[model samples]
Target: MSEALEILKKYWKHNEFRPLQNEIIDTVLSGKDAFALLPTGGGKSICFQVPAMMQKGICLVVSPLVALMKDQVANLQSRDIKAIALTGGIKSDEMIDLLDNCQFGNYKFLYLSPERLQSEWILERIKNLDINLIAIDEAHCVSQWGHDFRPAYLKISNLKTHFPNVPFLALTASATARVKEDIIKELGLEKPVLYQESFARKNIAYMVFEAEDKLFKIEQILKKNPQPSIIYVRNRKSCLDISSQLQTLGFKATYYHGGLPSREKDKNMSLWMEEKAQVIVATNAFGMGIDKANVKTVIHTQLPENIENYYQEAGRSGRNRDKAFAVLLTSPSDRFQAESQFINTLVDKKFLNLTYNKLNNYFQIAYGEGINETFTFNLNHFCSKYNFPVLKTYKALQFLDRQSIISLSQEFSEKISLQFIIPSKEVVRYISLNPNGEEIILAILRTYPGVYEMDTVFNSALIAKKSNHPEKEVLAILEKLKEKQIIEYRSKNNDASLTFNEIREDERTINRVSKYLEKQNQLKKEQLKSVLDYVKEDSICKSKLILAYFGEKDADECGICSYCITKKRSPKDPDALSKKIIELLQNEDLNSRELQNRTQTSKDTIIFALQALLEKEIIIVKSNNTYTLKS
Candidate 1:
């Protein structure tokens, strides 16, 4: 324990360990398996990191998130701790070299995805390494009932055969009782010590509000709490639209989504992190592995599919132990949307079979072939080619990837090359006739000096920026130039790749994993139902409800939740509220949200008071949605 603490101090500059971290670390150091269930921002990484550092050999950490793996590896390197991540997209020779480095480089940590362990050669190489511990991050994925179930995780138990004595540590931020049991059973942990911290966050007041005008409500929430915040939307378009709207409404806001270029994502995230932007409107892609203390509020504008996701995302706030809010803004249409988006898009065995058959056909794979074959997969292009629904097809591909039928790598970017075929004088004459192509051609020629000499790779985004046009427009101009034989052009539009792990027995493949797929679909429905219940159940305390979902029983009512506040404010005093509203309006015009904030009451009470005042003609609503006392 002393050694662990010393390592923590030396590297992290922290004197004391967080709750439950010490016990988990002690269990691992004693050569015993451990299961750790800590909430977000509870310092889960430190438990495995500090303990692994105290020992001699490398710790093999299996994680499902590539972004998180890169971040941790970078962070450890910055602190001079030797670490390496065996992520995807590496050549076979490069992967072997990395394994060799892990064997002889005196590294302390080796991070890789669970899917990487599927290869027998890799497993053989791993057995050769002097491993001290096996830490499984996001261990809930091993469970069938877990929110993010991956079939590849079940194969992790194979490690026990290779290294019988190495202790395994399983860690997760959010897991239900079933998930916990499954993690223990699937990981083959031998009488592991379990450390579960309470899921309750006393500082966060979980509140659910049904709003007709959600933007107005969001504005009210943001206006009242003028601190660093995150507003979660459901899609990339919404991220852009809502952030733009907020900026138009005079808020310092930025946007983040998965489709954004990495540079843009980092810049937008930095803007919000450095306080240059007060809020970041983003999709679910933004907050994993992020620790942002002092976030006063987290608002979700749409309905989340499950409670686990909502809890993990909302838990990002109030880490500094300050009073914060987890606000969920719902509407009458949210339930239908949730069902249509989540439930309807769930791929069953039939859809899976069709997708697998079509995919093999698209690549012209023989029935008994395509094992270990890889191809660049453009999702939009495939969907357009087959006239398949984009969402359902994507889900099918993901299902195949999860079932280990194929390894889908979404990190693949298109390779493009260009070379001018005509001389400079011919190009100038062509540009004079084709004025629309002039800017893009000039931008590319200016950017790439040797376009006429050889095929030069270029960034379309940079060309678009230089030409003051959208990337799509620039691509179109280049395609036109290619058609006219003015330039040589080649581009692969696929931003993803798929590697088949099995032969193309389409029906057999789908049949093999059909049961798991059906069970997953059912589990998703149940999870969504729980989320709907949480949102609609106004009688119970929201915080207690979340705790109970995570198997925490007999929790006391959180005094700060909407239900507790409303329950305490029973026997409504309508007349008194109306009088309060009149007095507030006499001083200055205010909206319902402002009145609710100032009066420390609910929106219903404020609305009721304003309606009563308007009925008596004592107050009137101004053009800007504020109520004012009649002159």
Candidate 2:
């Protein structure tokens, strides 16, 4: 074994590398661009991580999801690796400190969001830092054709110009043939070695059932599997409602969505991770960074907008190489609803112009006024002031952010407590008045040595844990101190900033951009239609259909799928199936005994043919042994 493989086995406890992991690592280590299309739970992280360990400087991972970056950093720290995520949630001073650490400290990996790429300070720092490899996770986002396209990803290609020697590795769990080409073109990668694994999960049985009552179907599915599962809904409200319904059905369920507070989100996630909750009903926001490997099933209550999203979510199950199920429960109306959503949600040029105008009005800025000036924006208030739907308006602003016309900081509030508000001499006197509070107050003072002298934010929950009190108790104590004018406390919420690139907008340019967005939405609709056709088509093997969609050819039918099984049980000819019995069974429902008497053929032959027809869905079994035509 090579030296790199030895480190991988020693640290990761895996004797051998997964299919494409070793090759990917070798390509990256050799200082060449590589695009790796590994499915979810396929150890995409290890591809960069192992090479990062073997290489000389910090590996910079540009990820789009903040939560996912934090999760990966936490996982790395758990294994005694030095990692940090530079995100907008922290204070500017804190971010500077972290950047300094990455530059000076012996850190192996520095994960950052794509939005951070435009920061002049960050760019300056990167110019000097010894960045060994630049890895872009979810590289599909760089492509306009991808499901989750982000404009800021376009700035990443500039890194290649800045660091000419650094190799770039783009990794994504799901991407189409068009998206793959777009990723390569957008990221400016060389003619890199392309590694795409087969997009087939044999352990996951793909099943779709049409039902009027989806909750009932979910209950039936749970009763059959009764293992760790995820129920995906379309919106945040559905996440809560379905979870409540599941709880009433005697299952321990929790809900997760973007609307929940950070601490609450953490608590709910921990509950599910610890197996204290049997299931999690969530929106698409819940699964990005989740690494649980034993999920027995993944149920989607509605169709996803694209197959890429569907495949990534479904691939979450069966990570342990165990048999799992991926079921989609749909109704006839859902197809139309999804189509309407896709059409209506398109961020065309007119909407973008109107939105840009409204945003300027909100900031009270003229065409040339708002440049480099940063202020927190209230999206809800702006929408209300302009009489636009909040969700649509928010989406429009997101599009603007993508176009680099503005930047949005997702709302995040941080818990903060002041060390002291009174003079140093008055602290002893204030504590003497409240003897019971004096011990706790003094203990906090001693615990956080330099907090009073400097502005540093510490985790309140950690402080409470060390102080031997509930978090609420610590918060209350801080509140009491604040009321007495002995200390100060405050929290910061997530906000948005509008940054203009230029003073004037050309009308024709705006219209052209709008037309392009409309065309993109139309393309997305076609992609979705293809996905739906794949799901409902009964003639093709499910696995073969998916592999073919990703541009792989000559794929064989997966014999384990329902389509293949049904084919195997189908009768060669309905006309030769005990003719007299078929005649008797076609006219009315007849029991086996009655059919045998009328046909004069043995009961076994009649039964066998009937079973074959039933399996082929040509006949329906009516009461006990009675049979009737499917129509």
Candidate 3:
């Protein structure tokens, strides 16, 4: 215990362990398998990391996300602790080198995806290493009922046979009782001690509001909090739109999604992390490895797919133990939209068979012989070629990736190359004719000196920045130049790539995974219903409702949640509220937010009072959307 505390203070510079961390570490130190269920931001990494540092040999960490693996490895390396990660796309020579390093280079931690463990060569190399512990991150992925079920995780238990004496620690942020049981059984933990910290976040004020204008509500929440924030949307378009809107309203805002180039994503993330951007509007793709503790508010503009996702995203707030907010703004149509997005897009067996067959045919793979074959995949191109719906096909591909039938690496990119076919004078004349293309054409010619001789690959983002134009505008200009025959231009959206891990027996492969698919779809439907029920509920405290969903039944009511506040005002007098609103408006015109602040009442009561006044013609909404006494 003293050595563990010393390791924490020496490396992590933290005086004390977060709640339950010390106990979990002690269990592992005593040579026992442990299952730890900590909430998001509960320092789950430390539970395994600190104890691993106190041991003799390296800790083998099996994670699901490549990005998260790299992040943890980098954090460890930053502290002068040697760590290595074996992610995808590594050449054999480099991989052998990395394995040798782990075998003899005194590396303290080795992070790799579960998919990597399936390779016989890598597994054999791992067997020779002095492995002290096995730490499984996101352990719920092994469960059929977990929010993120990855079949690759089921193969992790095979490691126990290789390292029979090593202790295994399974950690997750959220899981149901059923998921917990699945994790324990699937991971083959022998009499594993279970440690579950309470899921209640006392500093976060859970708030749900029904608003006609979600953007308006978001603006009000941000204005009131005025600290670092994240607003989660469902798509990339909304990420751009809302971030732009927030910037227009004088907030330093940025956006992030999987589609953005890695450079731009890092730039935007840096802006938000360094506090240059007060808010970041993003899709679910953000916040996996991000740990900014000062996020004062997390607002969900649309309904999430499940309570697990909602709870995890909401819990990102208040990590610094200050009072923060978790707000969900809903409209009448959100339920329909949520269903259309999540449930409607679910892939069935028939659709999956179609997708799998089309994929094999598109790649020209022969029956029973495409094992270990890799292909450069462009999802939009595939959809266009097969006349398939993009979302459903993507979902099907994701299912295949999760089942380890194929590895889908979604790293968005664009490959651009061009050659000046016509003479240099002709290109100059064309640029003059199209004034908007002048800057970009000149920047490209200057950047790529050999463009006049042969087709040269160019960095479009760099050219766009050099020419003071957006990347889309630069690409459009290049397209126009190609149309005019001044240059031979080619641009390809190389969005992602796929590697087949099984023989090309299309229908048989689909049949083998059909039950998992069906059960998962049913689970998704149930999860969606839970989300809707949670938002529709008004009597139960929001925090309590969330805690109970995760199998915590005895959580006390949080007085700061929207439900508790409304319950406190249940016996309110409409006349009294109306009078307060009237007096506040008489002095000056006030919007609903201002009125609520002045009267210190709930938003529902203010809206009710405002509606009554409007029906009786005692007050009117001005053209500016403010309330005023009728003259």
Candidate 4:
């Protein structure tokens, strides 16, 4: 125990470990493959971090979330631990430099996306590094049946064959019985030790409200709780709209979504982390990597598609073991919308094939030509060119990626700017001959420093504001200048910001692949519904429901849950009056005589008691006949 404490103090500041964490660290230190299924905010990272500190070689952590990797790496660096992430944002030369550092710089952790496993150069270089363990975060993503499946994760099993002696650790916050099996099989773990912490969060009060107006209910909830909270919506536009509404209502609110620029997202996250913002209105994309422990409430304005998502998101609050609230706001209309979205995602085989073919045709690639080719896809452009719904097309592409039919690069956009070459006077003279262009030209020159030298990317809105002109006018002036060869201009097509690398196939083949993928998606929806059914069920204990879902049979009902507490408070003999009424009826049809005969009671009590029995239909009144038990 002292040795464990020493390791903890030497690396992390803690003198002790969370429940089961020390045991997990010890197992990894002993060089064994382990699967850890801890709930959200259960110190999963420390399990790997502490072991990595005690190990003899670097620990290679493959994570699906880039934002999470960046955050973890920053934290590690702040602790004076050498850590680096090889992400898509880095240039090839820079990546090579980083990999070289990993090979020789004695770095203890190398974090990367699973897709990086496909990089031949990186794989070749790993042969020389002493990797003690390979840790896969969000291990559930490796399973096709998991809520968030990534095809690249399937390639991870190859690592076992490549490094036969190295130990592995797979960790996630949530997984069903099927998903657990899939993860074990997909990763090729050999009878790995499984550690599952109870999913019950006793401190979180689970409340579900049926709402006629969800927004109003949300406002009411905020007014009551009035603490640092997160209101999760379903889309980016909702994040903006709801945040705006909250501000109008005099709440300190901000919004976060994937559509925002990375810097803006980071800024909003930082604000929330620092508690400068009382509430964050966001889509599902916002909370994955957040570690703020004192989140007082998590209110869902729209019903989550499934229970796993609901559980994970709602579990975000109450991490400090203090009382917190997880509220779900649902209306009839919202339920219909959610159900519709689920149904729409069920694509027909013919439609899937047609869309797949259209995607191939849009890329001008034959069936077998696109295996490793990287192409930039514009969702809007693809929709316009192929007559497909933009949102559906995007989702279809994601499904294709999950099906391992293609690999997607992260999505990106282009920014164009101009740099000045000669002084403003020289450029003025060059374009002075064109009448009616001087104002726009001067505006352009004044807005940008080196407009005549080279092409640069500048924010269009900023340029418009500086020039005191409409953006259209500024763009026209730049285009005209480019035609005259007075300045060079180029459009930088940022990486697709998202990429989809289709597996090589003949265009005509795999047209029916979409049907199978759609079926798999429907099956997943059914599985999600089953989880929700457990939540809505009134008979089973809440703790027992969760435990059963995880394949733990024989778990007792936690007396602290709402269901158990309600049962405890309920009257044991609610129909006690019925028996007394029946006894009175045994002699003759008696109106209120039953109460007196059964027990000494007042007139008001007798009337109330008679009303309760009548309401329950336990007794019947024949036409003009005295009341008696309905036999």
Question: Candidate 3's residue-wise lDDT over 1-631, tens digit each?
Answer: 4888999999999999999999999999999999999999999999989888988889999998888988888899889899999987788999999999999899999999888888899999999999988999999999999999988899999998998889999999999999999999999999999999999999999999998888878887888889999999987767877988888898999999876668998999999999999999999989987888989999999999999999999988989999999999999999999999999999999999999998999999999888988888777557756768767988899999888888887454446778899988887777777787788888998988767865565667677767988878988988887888888887776657789999999889999999999999999999999999999998899999999999989999999998887777666688888888888887899999888767777677788889999999999998999989999
In Å, residue 139's CA in model 4 sits off its true spot by 0.6
Q: Which numbered prediction scores highest in TM-score against the true structure?
A: 3
| RMSD in angstroms between candidate 4 and the native structure over all alpha carbons | 13.3
Worst 10-residue stretch by lDDT in candidate 1?
A: 410-419
What would the C-alpha RMSD of candidate 3 be, to one decimal place? 7.2
Candidate 2, residue 414: CA error in Å? Answer: 16
Q: Tell me the spans in candidate 2 whose CA falls farther than 4 Å from its real position.
A: 412-495, 506-509, 569-631
List where candidate 3 sits over 4 angstroms from the true fold: 364-369, 372-376, 407-478, 481-506, 570-573, 580-604, 610-631
Better by lDDT, candidate 2 or 1: 1
lDDT of 1 by residue, 1-631 (tens): 4888899999999889889888899898889999999999899999889988988899999999988999899989999999999987788899999999999999999999998998889999999999999999999999989999988899999998888888999999999999999999998999999899999999999989888888888998999999999999998667877888899999999999876668998999999999999999999988987888999999999999899999999998899999999999999999999999999999988888998999999999999999999887777557656778877988898888888889888575435778899999999999899898888889998988767865565667667777988879988998888899988888866578789999888788788889999999999999999999999998899999999999998899999987887788775588887777778888888988888878877767778778878899999999999889898
| TM-scores for candidates 1 onward, in order | 0.84, 0.77, 0.85, 0.75
Q: Which stretches of candidate 1 lie over 4 Å from their true place?
A: 366-370, 412-495, 570-572, 580-601, 610-631
lDDT of 4 by residue, 101-180 (tens): 98899999999999888888888887678898899999999887787888789899999988888888999999988999
Ranking by TM-score: 3, 1, 2, 4
Give per-residue CA lDDT, model 2, range 1-631, as digits (tens): 8877987987788899988999999999999999999988898999999999997799999999888998999988988889999876688889889889998999999999888888888888878888999999999999888888888898999998899889999999988898999999999998788998878787877776666779877887888888889998997667877888899999999989875668989999999989999899989999998989999989999988888888889888889999888888878898888877766676667777888876777777766566666777765446646767655777787766677666666652234635576776788887787776665676677766655553344445555655666767777887888888777666445445556664535354366467557756777888888778876888987777777777777887777665676667654344665465557766788876566546644445667877777787877887686778778
